[model samples]
Target chain A: MNIPKITFIKMNKKEYILIAGLLILGLLSYFFMYNIEPGAMVKIEVSQKLYGTYALNKDQEILVKDSKGVILCTSEIKDGSIRVKSSTCTDKICIKEGEISSSGQTIICLPNQVVITVINEKEQIDGVLK
Target chain B: MNVKKLTLIIISSIIFLSLIYFYMNRNIVVAQTQFIMNTTIEIKLFGKNIDKQKLVKTMNRAFDIMKEVEDKSTSYVEYEGNAASLNKHRGEYYMVNQDLIEQLSTSIPFYKLTSGEFNIGLYRTVNIWKNATDKNYLPSREEALNSIGNSTPDDIIVDKFNNRVKLPEDMEIDLGGVSKGYALDKVIVFLKNSNIDIALINAGGNIITLGTPVDRDYFNIAIQDPQSINKILGTVKLNNGQAIATSGSYSRYYEINGEKYSHILSGNSGYPKHLYKSVTVITNKGIISDILSTSLFLLSIENGRKLIEKLDYPVEFLYILNDDTIIKSEGFKIEYSQDNLYKDE
Candidate 1:
């Protein structure tokens, strides 16, 4: 009985270098896409539109305005957390919600149609039950 | 073939295969948020083979389902075949949408289970309180008591065959307690039918998971502290087909004359009971979780346990008492955050 033998192909030094380079490129891209450093940015959306994203490290007051240039609310980012300092809405529930420092935490002012969410690249929690 | 040519071919094929592998294994997540049912409704879809556009379209369809439920169940606005219309034609058999009939019929049994604590027939009482809150004054005790009509869910005549319903005289129905959960259930059905797995729908505070996450065994859901707005009480792990719903008095309330009144009004007393600051329930069904959370929040701790024992569906509960005491079921696993203030009971 005759048996078939499998033959393997051997690569030269240049080919090996090319393969290694390609593998490194793939690994780098993978890490670049997935292993993002947790950022401290808070995204403010007004009426379902992306109003702006502000860094949490900055201690500044953001005056969220409407389309007609009317200031709806004032949000303060202090000590790596943000809170609604004041608002023109009636409920004032947004002001009472207090400060949110963690990723995925949100302070929603329904009366003014504004939602401020802490946006981190690596979110600690998928969703929050309020 | 020459050795050099064979090496070049092998390297090219290796790179090609890796590219295909990466493309096929790409995990795409699409999330969108819309304000519906008086709160934000966020739909998140997770899949390997679907594109972002398709996922977003599916999410819009899911939001449409929720909007349909809101249109049918909202008492604030009167639609053709919604709760408002039914309330308008009380004491007579009014033809309505089949979805409303199904929702009412499904919720009626809970009225008996909770002993009228979970009543949908408190719209009039709700309106009175809402009006009082808007006017910045408290309603008179007599006025609030008179608004609490004696109509029970038993008096609701649901003619399934005709797709119509009749409410007892002076009984107004508000499906606020179950509408969000009902919408979640409907959206889940639609998502499953679309052959998309591993999704999460959060209608305000009520969250439902379709399948386990791609990178994790279960979805990590953080329960907000009722005492403090920024702090979390703990984190709970929810597996596939499980939902968590919370009814917290601290989230929604009206302050009138230096007094706070929660929106969660008791069908029996026509007043909000501060048995617990927040009651969270985990169950297999979204509607059940929603209904049980609200019902259990209104009941005492002892009575709430009794109600849980009587239910056939598997459920886990966590109660945050007014004094910052946390009580959880034995099977519910929660990882307390560092610096957790609540004392475990």
Candidate 2:
């Protein structure tokens, strides 16, 4: 009976250097690609339209309305957080959602079809369901 | 090794590193957002296996359907097919859109389910509060009290055969509490019809999930702390076809001289209920969750629990008290973070 012998190939300097470079590249990609910044502004949308985008640093009130000119709600930006101050809609659920400061935080008014979202320097999160 | 073999090894190594770079650069989650139903609605889906174009198209369609629901059910808008017109023609029979009929019909049952605690016919009472809050003052006690019992849920007559409805002369219809949930339900139906199961529909504080996300056993949701809006006291994990609706006094309140008056008025008292900081109801039905959340906030915990026990659908409750105490139903599984000082009841 004859047995087949298995042998290990020795890696030279070039192969070792190439493998080390690949490992470093992978680590670099992981850090650079995954880093995300916090949200800086709150974007308000009413009925599928861009109502306005307000800086989180500024304190102001944004009166959001539907296309038909009905004032749906008032959004107040204060202390880097935005919240629904008042709404003509009966449920007033959006007002109850309080303020959203984080990048992925959101406040939605279903009755008014109003959506308010927090956005970072870049749109980092996949989606925000609030 | 020969030069060709060594060159091949380097080439393969380069290819492998580039593949890793590309994989890392690829988006892990795909999300789309639209302004719908007077709120910002975001539909987020996980996994790269989903068809991006189809999901986008489906999301847009869901918004359109939700808009239709909103338009039909909105009491603020006076379009030909809207609920405002129906309220405007309260004395006589007014032909309404099917969506309006369905929403109103769906909500009427909740009135009885909550022992008249969840009344949509309190439009007059709501208007009084709105008018008062608009002027930066609380409504006169007499005016608020007078608005109470002005109309009952029975005042709105639904004529199914004629496809019309009649409201009492003094009565008005406001679907504010139920319409959002109804819209969510309609959107869920639309998503299911499109063969998209793993989706979450969040209409403001009302959240509904169609199916669990691809990577997780359950969807984790943060319950906003009433005292601190940005921080969450705890999280609730929901399975497929589940929903959570939160009603709180802290959300829509009138602050006069530093006193916070919640907008969640009791149907019986005709004034805002200040017992709890917030009430969250987790259930399968959107409208039910919405109604129960509001009703539970309006009622005492004992009454609220009795109401929940009578309902056929299973539900869990969580209430954040004014003192930051957290009370939860036996079945509600909430994991509070170490930083939270709220005690569980």
Candidate 3:
């Protein structure tokens, strides 16, 4: 039996360079791209049991609640907007409806005890009316 | 040869390790540029802290939504005849836009409840204000009153079964006053769902707040002196989830002969009133706050007080009178700081 000759497969110079370059670039990009996204939430609490509803477009409803998870207000989403649809509160005022789609727009619950609003990861507020 | 191989390997390894380190920190080094469309409105928000970037984005979106409504609203003039166009011949019915039909039907109830004070069917009158080209100037008394008669909210016929609207001969409907508020409300919802912490969306001075200020003792919002917008009468402290809107003669008025005509004209008189120089309402509902702000400014103080008592939605009002005195409800708090450079009545 003739012993088969074993030969080393030498890597080509260009190929070696290419592989090294790609690995370095990929690793660098991957590490650099990994990031921590900022996140924050603002919680609006109410002292009274205010009945309210928030509607997106006077159609879709998002219910607002208290810390105990009791329903305080409902919201409706419409026309890419949200507003208070109905409330057990005397005014049915929130029911007169408003629109809020961004974190800044807010509706409060007066009777059932909740304040529903939007905020961000940083508690930094930008402007005041004064 | 061995030394060269070792040097090459060492260089490669060093390069590889450095690349890994660079990659790991890439996010921190590269600043992501974003295009944020921005618009600003001066409005009073109750009990919320707002972030600047979030507020700018919301305002931009709010303007975009306004354009959307203008395009889709049935009351909108179809520069091009399309599905959303309103036709008068259907006895108050026309092949209307689904969106417009729905919004009108929903807000129409408010018009009825407010006895047309909150009517969206003031298109004819609003057009008079809008159509005023620079050379055209504001309409003469006769012209202002001419087209206004046709705008009776009762006459705005919407055939629910057909989902259409029929306007009277000379009347039109305009949601300009409320649309911004409506847009502000939607942006609020968007921010909440995204779990943003604080923000303010102001569209041409329509203020909506996202959260209470972390630094403020309270959301210290100023109520502008209607007579002199640059001068503020006082500030209100808000803690959470409240919206404040001000309807003042100063916001939109045609100055002629030193007499100011408020943008909020009486649909009845075809003329603006000087009942109250400005009215600010604080509430959860932006639309209600916007409308009531105007209504209260136009209505008698007695009626205004009665309205607040009826609603009692934490609406602290500030009325700047023609006489230069301020009228605030009993529970209404107007915080005046010595630094706040304005005199309170």
Best by the TM-score measure: 1
Report backbone clashes per prediction: 0, 14, 74
Mind giving the per-residue lDDT tens digits that candidate 1 earns over B31-121?
A: 8899998898889898766777888888889889999989988877899989999999999999998779878988998888888788888
What's each prediction's TM-score? Answer: 0.74, 0.68, 0.55
Better of 2 and 3 by TM-score: 2
How are the candidates ranked when ordered by DockQ, highest leading? Answer: 1, 3, 2
RMSD of each: 14.4, 17.1, 20.9
Q: Write the per-residue lDDT of candidate 2 for residues B138-198, one digit (tens) a residue.
A: 7777787787656678678999888899888877878888888888888888878887767
**Candidate 3 overall lDDT versus native:** 0.58
lDDT of each: 0.86, 0.78, 0.58
Chain A only: TM-score of every candidate?
0.63, 0.63, 0.38
**Candidate 1 segments whose C-alpha is farther than 4 A from its true place:** A1-123, B1-25
Task: List clashing residue pairs in candidate 1.
Answer: none
| First chain of candidate 2, TM-score | 0.63
Per-residue lDDT of model 2, residues A7-126, tens digit only: 978879999899889888867766544422247888888888898888898889888877888889988999988999999988988888887787657898988889898886432322
Tens digits of per-residue lDDT for model 1 on A1-130?
9979978767689997998899779766764444212348999999999999998989999999998899999999999899999999999999999998765678999999999988773345778888
Tens-digit lDDT string for candidate 3 (A21-118): 99868775664444322213333446744334332223455666556776656656566555667666776656564654554445665555556554
